[model samples]
Target: MDFRNLWPSLDLIIDAGPIIQNQGNRNGSTIVDLSVKGEYKIVRDGCAKDQTVKILKEFGLKEIHD
Candidate 1:
């Protein structure tokens, strides 16, 4: 209520509750760091870790563990 009171002329104020997702099975997308040559840092797993690993190996890139 305080927020609205401060901004009486506000046009939009979304709650962000309706579009939230807690979890999902499939990997949204693989995020890998390719800064080091022939090496990769698995920043995030996408389509599951197995699939992401396979792709890295195919590209002759080794995963760096941190």
Candidate 2:
């Protein structure tokens, strides 16, 4: 059964309709890794993977992959 109608009343949902439609809430903004010092990871590629890498390198931040 189609569940799109319930989205409006649902408290939480992971529907990808918005994402597929290019209407994401964050517009692909990458998030910073603040758990460690002097290191970083791309939590979300968002819409700026290239830009994120450029800034990370400019600041000499090490990228860690877990």
Candidate 3:
């Protein structure tokens, strides 16, 4: 029941409810929040830039100066 070891990869999302329940530390931040808020934002925002790389990669648009 190690919640620390229940992170989801980009290739798949595993259900970590049991582990979190057993560990008794449900802050309600599920795997989706972890990936979407943490890793997804990192790749999207470039982590070193002020813009979203995902916008350029997905739509071939340049910097949105707004």
For residues 1-66, could you state the per-residue lDDT of candidate 3 as single tens digits?
565555553455533234233234333333222333223323232122322344334544443322
After superposition, the stretches of candidate 1 with alpha carbons farther than 4 Å from their true spots are: 1-24
RMSD in order of candidates: 12.5, 10.2, 13.0
Q: Evaluated with TM-score, which candidate comes out highest?
A: 2
In model 3, where do residues sit more than 4 Å from their true spots?
1-12, 17-24, 31-39, 42-66
Off by over 4 Å in 2: 1-27
Which model, 1 or 3, shows the larger lDDT?
Answer: 1
Worst 10 residues of 1 by lDDT: 13-22
Candidate 1 per-residue lDDT over residues 1-66, each given as its tens digit: 356565776543323223223355544555667778889897876554565577679979887888
- TM-score, structure 3 vs. true: 0.18
Cα deviation of 65, candidate 2, in Å: 0.6
Kindly provide the TM-score of model 1 when superposed on the true structure, using C-alpha atoms.
Answer: 0.51
Overall lDDT per candidate, in order of appearance: 0.63, 0.62, 0.35
